[model samples]
Target: MMFSSKKRQRGTLNREQKKRRLFLFTVILAIAILFGDYHSTIASSVGKETLTMITSPDYPPYEFYETKDGERKIVGFDIDIANYIKKELGFKLKIAQSDFNGLIPALQANRADFVMAGMTPTPQRRENVDFSIIYYEAQDTIVASKSSNLTKPEDLSGKIVGVQLGTIQEQNAKQIAEKVPNIKLKQLNKVPEIVQEIKAGRIDAAIVEDTVALGFVKANPDLQFNVIPSIENASGSAIAFPKGSQLVKPFNDVLQKMKNNGELERLSKKWFSANLTEEPLSTNSPPAASKGLNLDFRRIIPDIPFILKGIPLTLSFTLSSVFLGLFWGTALSFFKISGIKPLGWFANVYTSIFRGTPLLLQLSLVYFATPQLTGYDISAFQAGVFTFTLNSGAYMSETIRGGIQAVDKGQFEAAMSMGVSYPMMMWDIILPQALKNILPALVNETIGLLKDSSLVATIGVVEILRSAQIVGANKYIYFEPLLFAGLIYYVLVMGLSFAASALERKLRRSD
Candidate 1:
């Protein structure tokens, strides 16, 4: 009887405990739900609607690059106006980044709901994408070297002009070039490159929107550039909504309010020094007749003058690292090939660490952290060059090792049988053949260095991308300037590609 009573008590206690746990869990879950709701955005619960926003964070004073500093937070006029629209309509805003040309495709593919990258609403772009009410007015301007004698469209005759790809300025420059007969236009992806090229005298002049031209001039006060006062056609910049978006009316309503309430003017003054909200669609305005100077690209290919000033710095850094990498890679390859246990193991570990990690991270560590650790400070450019070389070396080592191993063992032994010195044999025979096998890859690495040089911008090398950003931020036409930069990069990459192809053909013929 006692045992039965004890067992019954125990069973009751277990049931009570289990019930208590269940009750606690239910309460906690309810609290979590309430907290989530409390923190939810106004449109979080709204179903069947999402506002997808795409932008490139390369420009400043408009839509500059976002950094971890929270200072890089989106505070430009675009964000302000977009938020106002979102508030009025009660739709969630989803933001993304799209390339200058990719914005429309993203909208078409349903990857983005809209684009707000300071896009100028042009007739050609309208064929593919729908734009909302014009939010700002803009004009095209020329950026040129101050020393250049170009004063008018006719002055551009027989000069090299730079412009952004896919922009009204590019089209205008082309039209003017066609009419003028002597001017040549070089279209690029980013504006900074144009600024740099102009400063370096790579191009005689660059055509950009007025705002961006102002930015370039501001950044380079000592760099003389004349801004012709005669204005180009003025165009309206508008938020491009996806085709058939219901959000357009709501956005337009907010934009009208912003314009009416002077909020738009306030933003424009804060960023652009003047209001661009009025007369947003005056694309037929005359070209700038101002006396401002800008970049000139009129000379022969390679812009020999600028190339002479800057390409040496660029090539010097590249060759120094490339040659160093070749030496280190060869040593590592030999170690890996030696069949020696510890040396091979060490070489493998070295290759894996560098190959597995990002070059940017390594650059930061070496450039920023190395000073703290080793008490030696290196220039950002040098660090960038060194980091690239080291990274390339590790990858190249594997290529070299593969090539070395690929050579027939019989050939090596035949030289040995001839009692040839090992060093002489390698120099006369093995290295020559191995180099032939690896020449294609070496050339690829060189081309890669050209692109990677842009990364130097992160550490402040003012290579093409940084120069574009500096200029874009000056007047807030981030898209146009970046487009110019892209053109420079494209031309460089294409030229290198052509050379690589020619080199490959030559090698094949020799073979």
Candidate 2:
């Protein structure tokens, strides 16, 4: 009886041990799978060459986002061509996005391996970047309100004609302006923005590529486009690459092959033949038909969720920048007041340099130059944070210096008399008082950072403003969405102000 009881106990213990081992094995397998998946998602595969392609996706039928079943996918003719080339060259392709004006700068900065945004190869552009063989030739069109009846370049005399900045169309408009009398030109950043100006009656007409204009015209029944007569040296789009890139020849070879195999024609027909004018006019109508600052906020109702999603990113960026800037600024303030000559001189020079230059220029330099200077491809968000931190630190250093100096010298002497070390005294006693004195200034700086956060949009950080821009581009209306974004900003700033004021009162209680 005793032996049987012992045998039973031994069997139970063995079963428990096996269960424990199985549990641990399962956990280990799960962790391994998660780590492997994350690594593969973020980094290129080993021994597989990956090329980064940059483009402006607002150009439909070339590259644009289509939301289906709560997922956004970039689809169009250019994407098809890129996929074909990637397969032919046996290289993995990753697409990066930026504003149209920033694409060339991105290539110069080595931020992309190639550009395929239906870009033209002009003489000025050839000086900076190499080009593949022309794949598509597009005609210029004069797009205007249907009632305007403005049909030709000659009709643009004394009229405010809108064109996208840094495009072949803008250059074409300039040439026309020189020959046509009193042709006032207004350059915007995107084709949709130019179209908006026409709808709002702020501009008489806009010059856009025909394929792009067709998409807009179909969506908006109130608009019409007239094809401009093709002149010598007409613009044609080709792939753009960094100067002397070896991939240019391979890309051109694949393009030639596609042409020979009828693949190019197949893709062109697939994208171009599809009617994009399916958007219901009643639902997506613009404010043009109404008089005197008309707005239909209902049009952006569906996109509200998309635009609101940017708030978290904007807030995170601002808070991160402010915290990092505060730390750096405090350090710089110490250096400025250290009584060490070299440290003081270095701090002074740094402050002067940052304060003298424009913030936008600094942002551009950091975002575009960091990759070339250090082989690390700094993302748009990182570049924005780093640049804002550095720039804010310079200004805050001066503020902090004043605050530290304004602290009663007797407090420091008293601490020293109590045998407190200088660093400890500053950290525990001096900084507390100095911070109180500069709290208002710091709040002002925070507010400024919040507003300046919009600048990151230029470098492709899709914060609040960029989200609004994307919605505007998709809907083909400017003022309504932009005004809505302004309302959001105003509300945010007000809320921040209220919170800061409450904190100020709470801090005053300690006094």
Candidate 3:
């Protein structure tokens, strides 16, 4: 009886201990989760909603497109960090691509929440946007032909040094020029272009970042890069947001956590090990430019479908722009002859400004300045279509006005003699004749707009030119893919021409 009592007491004690251990484990887990949350976003949830980020994906290891197993994804150090932060903050992340020059503009237009393109935060940039704490440090390099022996900043004296437009390196080159004599800066749009210029001897040297320069030199043994000595304010890449954004504090918090937990170091190791070519979309031999631009279409066969995907987008943009331009142009033509001083003056001034300024300039202003000036988040597509429409309207309005005036005055008199209203007379008698007269010119305008659609690539529209650029950047080759894209544009234009000719015949038959 004593043994039985002792055994029962021991059993009850064991059960109590088990329950206590389980309760303790739960408490510990809860605390750990709370601690993680606190570290992740400063204990506040900036969670939910998808955030869009803009980056110049041409810069690899930082952010570039990877094609694997027939699937394409944007993969790089920045993308990984972004994903981790999104997971921590409980938000979905969408990445958008743009030219390096367009990255800040995209942010200004609210086309993206932030930019992470290995971009250094310079004073000029800080004036327009806010930046998070520095995440990675990179040095500028002077890349030149091994034979040119341009290793130092002083060596670039009396040389045409190339730098990418709108880059911190451009600012660096200017500073160097102030110190070095006779340094003529030649600004280009891409590093690849700068490399070609160096090879062609058009430019003696280029100011490129060390990480990017490393990959270029490796791909082309003919070139070498020497790191420029660190500058006074040796700043590094930080996440950039629109000026006065609410996301500034939260992004900074997440970045701080990444720094403390060594996440940033881990990413730096993964990406900084090699340059862009380490993640080539094609495994074939590199382009044989040394052999006088030896063309290789086989290397891009795997990427043909990718480039073809741009067709639909191109068509949509072109059609939308052309139709909108037609409508707007017709309105402006009416205003030109409306005899209302205010409307005429407004339309005339509008035409003069759009006509006087370059289309590219107008597009940039509409895209970058719209958000700040209007507080509306204008998208890349919207900006492209709107700019094209306005430009086409400026040109088409004059054509339309000429077509309208050329109509026989007797027709207006005849319509009025029939007791027709002014609106009815203009709509029925004047417009039909004017449209017929301008049909060929209208077709020409359509063709012009179709070609001009390539400009949208500057602002990150994944149309023909941008897709070709992506493939070329991935393959470390330029000419073949661009030729193919040009061929596609040619075929499209030819098809459009055939269709227009057939439509003209049909309209003549109807008459």
lDDT of each: 0.68, 0.85, 0.84
Poorly placed runs, candidate 2 (over 4 Å): 1-48, 67-73, 219-222, 276-289
Ranking by TM-score: 2, 3, 1
Expressed as tens digits, the lDDT of each residue in 232-284 for candidate 2 is: 54779899999988888778988999999999978877876554334424223
Provide TM-scores for the models.
Answer: 0.49, 0.84, 0.82
Best by lDDT: 2
Estimate the TM-score for candidate 3. 0.82
Q: Identify the runs in model 1 with alpha carbons over 4 angstroms from their true place.
A: 1-50, 66-72, 222-233, 274-511
Flag the better candidate by lDDT, 1 or 2: 2
Q: Give candidate 2's whole-model lDDT.
A: 0.85
* Candidate 1 Cα lDDT to native: 0.68
Better of 1 and 2 by TM-score: 2
Report the lDDT tens digits of candidate 3 across residue range 374-453. 88877889999999999999999999999999999999889999999999988988999898889999999999999999
Estimate the overall C-alpha local distance difference test score of candidate 3. 0.84
In angstroms, the error of model 1 at 417 is 32
